[model samples]
Target: MEEKYFTPEEKKEMLALSRQLLAHTREIQERDDFKRIRHIISDGIKQNHYRRDRYGINPTIHNLNTAMLLCDKISPDRNMIIAILLFNLCKTEFIPTEELVKEWGDDIAKLIRGLLKVSTLYSKQAAVESDNFRKLLLTFAEDIRVIIIMIVDRLALMRTINHHPNEKMVHDVAYESNYLYAPLAHRLGLYAIKSELEDLSLKYTNRKTYTDIAHKLNETKVKRDQYIAEFIKPIREKLDATGLKYEIKGRTKSIYSIWNKLKKQKNDIDHIYDLFAIRIIIDTTTEKEKSDCWLAYSVITDMYQPNPSRMKDWLSIPKSNGYESLHITVYGPGDRWVEVQIRTKRMDLIAEKGLAAHWKYKGIKSEGDLDTWMNNVRDILEAAETGPMELMKNMKMDIYDKEVFVFTPKGDLYKLPLGASLLDFAFHIHSKLGMTCTGGKVNGKNQKLNYKLKSGDTVEILTSTAQAPKLDWLAFVVTSKARNKIRQTVHEMNNRSATLGKELLERRFKNRKIELNESSLMKVIKKLGYKTVTDFYDAIADESLDINNVITEYEGLDKKIPDAAEIRSAEEFQLMTAADDDSTSSDVLVIGDDIKGINYRLSKCCNPIYGDDVFGFISAEGVIKIHRHDCPNATNIREKYPYRLITTRWSGKLGQQFGATLRIVGNDDLGIVTSITSIINKERDTSLRSISIDSNDGIFQGFLVVGVNDTVALNNLIKKLKTVKGVKDVQRSK
Candidate 1:
């Protein structure tokens, strides 16, 4: 792609602004030690040039106009800080320089990148890609200033979206603002940005609905304002009489929120009760803040009868994001349901700015508790998978899921996703604890691993080294940490087997003096059209690799043949079949057929489970073994033993519990396992015999065996397992 340079006029304007910014930057540099800020800004501008070329956008006056508008929305000082942060963040090689380019150049680039990263913190994509979560977590972990920059960036974008014309772009920006930015602003206590983003997103995402509701609200604007003014009169007088300073203001619910209420409650515009809310901001000491708020509420209720059900006491135990207010719905004059929120000015600011406000006023050097919680969120996101749909679903669940506050035996409170299981509790304590968790006790009562934890429940996870993850536990455990630990353990075990298989193949090849170079072997293996070397090794390690076919192709090329039959196959084949079976003449009967005078062994791949359809394969050792037809080795044996095949059926009585393995893959969720177990146990006759589950990057793979009667019952069990929350696919073990 040809490089696109700025037009003379555009360059002149940008250069002029750049020079102006540079001059002002000198003062900030001396005051705040921003020495490297200039270099960062220069680099950002160069990078933006690269992106402009790639995106095929001419650096014309029109584009410059958009950039100028963006600049207008941003403070130069704040943009400078954001620029420094972005330069530091983009030091990694994976992020292309072109993608990091900003139209407003480097000054805005820093802010844009910081904002993008922060936006990603609550994004669906962040949930799927662990690296994204790690990046975001580390960013927040280091300095919350990055988050503030991000919020500011979004606010600026929302303000300047009018410059863009793409409907899809507009809708996306609006949806993002609504679902992610708005809630995040609310969480961070950036009420101004939060409310604006919500209103903007609502305007675009649901224009018709927003317009209808907004029109209705506008129609009643005068009456609503007058009513609110009248309603706050008595409360203001009462507070003045109590000798406390206070200010009263009125707020209407955001249009988007009103539309949601209309849809959820199946109500019209007129039926919305909390449409117009009155705010009572008071000035009080922290120690007496609650008392003063309650006193205000009492005064308001005395003048207007309060609806007991409509009262919310967030002041007692604030939200996870640090929102605090006393919300009450009272029957106002003329039977109107007037919502009132009472809080001190400090509380109001905190409620508006969330964690940001906390940092600003508290002047705490670090994020402290908020950082810890966000780190946990990072863990969840890192363990989740990526993709638009997957991210959207999982991100919504993680960021917006209802939280339950549970206590440890030591009285420390841990906030967990609602419906979290005991396993989640265990993992929340420590990753190792989750891996070794056998069960747990909720409030002094011993319960299964799948036990649903409730708020205020004191949980103690039962763990042991001997108690590794059972496949069945995958059904009951919730929380990404627990799921990720389970997945890592299972992957390690599978990988060990794969490694062993590779070694076994290498040793066998070496015994024949055949040099097995990995590169050469892989070429030959690929020529045979195998998908992966591991698949070939797994086949060989499982004694399923067809050496006869391999050797037949290479016969006479080398002269290591002792006999024609032995030469027809490979030496590896002889070693595999040389085991003695004659010493054990046990006639193991299966499926009403007796293979006399031959040793019989059960295949571990399928476990046969007593009632599964089975077959017998005669080995070179004269051992007749039973295996399910769906076993991984079945296809090889079937192709080799077309004439030797014997149809076998099970005659044994069904057992209450049979050993089998099920592989499941699905979208990850907070309480997936618990939901699965709840479904399984709901039948009462079934038990989760054992389970091993692992999840990372939003993909969940589990191996489970549950108590069942027969194949029919197992299929039914799988059918039921599919209904478990967050489960995508369940397959019977081959």
Candidate 2:
């Protein structure tokens, strides 16, 4: 071991924590495994395999803390503890997987592999809010223990983050804990870990509010304890007479929960009822667990008036995470409502330890529901073109929602999130069924495809050979599978149309005995204001652009051709004011004040307004064309003609107007177009040159071509138009 890497006290603390962790797995403590693990770590230290993380926290201490948390709270097995110990060594490649497998076994090696993959993902600095990152996390975590270990690792980090040297690291870790890890823990039924994570997150992120709540809880501890004791007194007497072997304890709500209620309900802590809950854990056999819990519920409700709406019977159908409990809110002493939870020892274990406890009670209860959910995860991860973040939002919604159990006509049950539409269910059963579904008969009643399903409804789907998915189906389906499939189908349809359109145009040229010139066709396409050949062809297939018009433009290209010196790319550019902040010497073009000698103009493909990042592309004709850095053609220009590119920046202000187009969509309310025109007319130095409107299904989509002095004027017009009545969206045409 490297002695200089740690203080004497630090080394002693790590040694003690390591011993405590091994002790949880008694076989490892008794055998030579402990010393072997220690030797591996010493070797890792010699090779510099372990070091402080980016937050400047000791790796050894952190891993030990995480392992101890797993042991003390989760009741994990020997392999889980060993994996946590050697994870860092394996991650750094100091210990190869072959050696790990030969010594530690395959389970240990597999856990470390999952951890390493997740570690690599983190090194990319992906945001916690990124849905793709979250999906990939689950994909990498094939073993449930990998997720459990990660959750505990995050908890360990949160507990010691006060010692972190970087404030930004502290804040980011806290935010990730709150938004990402906390919800995951909740989903897994690790309520204790979830609550602690949320509370610690509040402590670091909002210290003032955390301190206020902490002080209030501390100040009222005495009175709160007395009230709980008084409330439990009579309930204890009733259960004791019944000769039930049970333990009852009072649990106060975490600081974060209190703060959330205060903020949401707009009430102080004093007004928050159910601030504490009384839990009753019974020692009963699995066969009698349900009956025993019911007996306790009867005894408690017999003594006090029970609120019917406040009762939750998870005992009948346990939660998706296998959490089983009976909760009842009763008017306790002083008429204050107090919540009581009744559960067996087995149920309590699963509730507190999540999947770890579920592993122990594997066959005692069916995990088919959980298995179904895991399969849904795989379905969502299928190859699709949708953005990962969008997919993640849909997945997160499913994770946080309560399941609605519906049935097929044959009595096969399917679980969906709350508010799941009929289409969502059809997709959940099978993708093909969902695609062809027009509507369904729910419990023998006809319902539309958009009908929201409820529990216990037997659904029989109705389909037709002529029925096809519509673009509007994306608006109703909530599942990512349905949404992704719809998008893919729509994209395929457009591609087919584009292909057909291309064939039709080519056949027309063949029939007319007119030779098609590729370059001339390109010029015609550009002149038609189409960015790509696909869009041009699709327009022809849809009959939006007349085929004869395209041929006429192609024939006229020769007559309208400019001289070589005057020819420039069809792209637009802008001149920024000298006052713009983006101005830099390196970005400025080397064109001097003798500007008349240069026959250059802004390219028409990308409209680069004033203050936009601009670059100069020297055309083959020696005409320098200014283009926006983000132009659609910029990538091709940069990749294929790197030598022709020159760094350019907007210089002196040119007191002239530039043309821009805006696309707007909103309700087809009375005079909505007039309202939009009025708003644009009010902006100074902004003029609307032309407008075209199309309306369908009470919705209107329009395009407006306007001339503005600069991007500033264009943006101002957009903002003012956004404020118009019935305007849902307004943005510059890309």
Candidate 3:
């Protein structure tokens, strides 16, 4: 499909959409500003600068739809609407950023730039299911408005995806809507958009299931309507007697939600209860919201028997996403369990519109709660140690999970996910507390570390210096923060043990008058069948691998030692020779702004390859160490010695190969190892250095060191490995 001039029909639709948008946005934007925005987009459309989207929809028409969606769904401000309308123009450079900024203001310009960055990210085929992609999207979209606009834009795309001819693209967009955009809408409290996106996604991706459920709901519509009417009649009379102003809505759960229930409960649509919910939106003042809701609840419960176990109170403590409502499940007519939600008009608006509505109710404390939650999301994205898919699951939990509000002994309250354990609470409070927590006393009763916490429990953490994070703790902690912290601590401990073990072996080698060859020692370890270098070092650290045994194995191994003149320490390596510089002159890596004759070597810790983003650190030994920007030690070094940091950049690719290690996890299928090694062998100027793999329960984790010239080569190799059968994830070993 290619871009075509807009047909007469398309032009008519665009004009109508433009008018609707202007009408809806009148409250937020001036008439002149809106016209100016429309004129720019219209000019771009005439010039054919705005190409047709994948669905073959006119670009101008699509932008109008997205802009109107933002207006109708979120009631966005003038700048947001302008940004979406002008996104394509700015992207195509028909209107340069400077011109747009001059015409508009800084805020609109920033939004366009962010939108462009996210568009570029999409070009890389970033999967929505990957947490890394989500983090990157959030990073590029520094403004929350950017995220909101993208969600609305996706809603527009999913709405029109059916027109696309590419089945694969349709599937991708549908799954992306379900797994990514829907969760985002949920997190932002866009309940209506979230549910609609979910339903649309389900309809496209699983048409059979969607149709089956839809058909069943349609067949039972009359019966369902009758029951709802019967249930609301008595409550309406009772509410009117109390003189409360309210509108009760009877709505069925979204098709996606019903599908989830059917799969989870292994039941048919006819058997699933609570498919529909009753929302009692009261027109009350903010001060009277709670009292009116409680009064309505008293009236409803008086009419029908309420289930004590199913009551949810969010009025006292609103949800992290700023949702405030009182939920009750009661046995209505025909002994049906029906969920009833009570909330004020303002609260209902916030619940439906999410972050956008928060602007209208800025004085409410829930807005701050939403802001804090977004910050926490950023932290989780940055600090999480799990794989992309696992982090995605954790993010979904954060978005849609029921919150349990627990208090500290000091009366400070913390909101955790439902089923959060005692250890999760400790970690949520402070990482140090989590590290040393022995157990906790919940509501003044002693509880074990694995004890699941309930709402309103005042917890006092019991700690001991002797206690530390364990591998077992990872199995129980429900929060991503707790799980990541445990894994990080355990990894650091193992590294420490490995370091001590290495030092011990080195000392022994020196005592034995044996020159320690790093490469030969690695060969010896592998020959002894150790699957990981860390395991080898751990064995030695615990005295399981005897010094005599290691020494004998090292002596027996075939080895090659470089000449004595070639051996040098970081102190001895003062500069790259003329020959060295000339060989790689085409891709000169400038150290310290091209300080001539100064020496630097890539740090062994992170193994910075050519083309890797790097920084130079002046070590205590007076030698400059080049490290990857994301080096594990980079954070500590930068924080402690800010003065020693120097900017580094690569002007071109280096000719020499660099040592890079990859950590691969996949199923332990037959010949999986051979499949991996074959790919490495097929690459030019790339060779496998060493490999160590461990298998358990049909899954394997392998570390393969390879020699590559640059980060490009390393990335390409990783991509190829990812395509291998049974390979789940392949990542550079930091």
Q: Model 3 clash tally?
A: 0
lDDT string, candidate 1, 412-483, tens digits: 556677788988888888887887677888879899888888645678778643345545667877677777
Off by over 4 Å in 1: 1-26, 29-150, 163-165, 213-223, 281-294, 313-325, 343-368, 371-734
Please give the lDDT score for candidate 2: 0.72
> Which has the better TM-score: candidate 2, or candidate 3?
2
Per-model C-alpha lDDT, please?
Answer: 0.58, 0.72, 0.74
RMSD per prediction, one decimal?
Answer: 24.5, 22.1, 23.8
Find the 10 residues in a row with the least total lDDT in model 2.
569-578
How would you encode candidate 3's per-residue C-alpha lDDT over 1-734 as one tens digit per residue? 11247677877887799789878866667659876865776677677777776557677778889988886776646777788888888888999877887888887798888789778655444345443345445555656677878899989988877646788888888898877777676666576888889898988888899999999889989999998999999889999999999999999887998998899879887667669989999998878889999999999998889988889898988866677889899987786788898999998866645443442342223323445565454434335555211233223223323556566665555667879999999999899999879898987899999999875567999985435577888878999999999999877767765765676577667754699988998899998889998888867754456665697689757645445485332111111111112122233567665654345666655668888889977543234667899876677667756866878887564568777868788887657777888999999988887675655677777667788888889999999999999999999876
- Which rank order by lDDT, best down to worst? 3, 2, 1
Q: Which stretches of candidate 2 lie over 4 Å from their true place?
A: 29-31, 123-125, 130-135, 234-249, 278-734
Which pairs of residues collide in model 2? 570-604, 570-605, 571-603, 571-604, 571-605, 572-603, 572-604
lDDT of 2 by residue, 1-734 (tens): 57987889888989798778766667434378778887888878887898776666888888889989986766635677788889988888888889999987776787888788777655445456643344446655656667778999999999998746787888988999987787666555566888899999999889999999999999999999999999899989999999899999998989998898789779888777668889999999999999999999999999989999989898999876677889899988787888898999998866645432432232223234443554343333333345211243224323323556566666555667778899989888888888778799997999999999875567889874324466788888888888898788667766765775686578657744579999999999999999999989877755566575687577666664445455232111111222222112232243433233233446544556666778776543234667778765577668756765666666555565666667788887756766877887788777777675555677777667677778888887888888988889997764
Q: Give the C-alpha miss distance for residue 545 in model 3, angstroms.
A: 24
| C-alpha TM-scores of all predictions | 0.43, 0.46, 0.46
* lDDT, residue 294, candidate 1: 87
Which candidate, 1 or 2, has the higher TM-score? 2
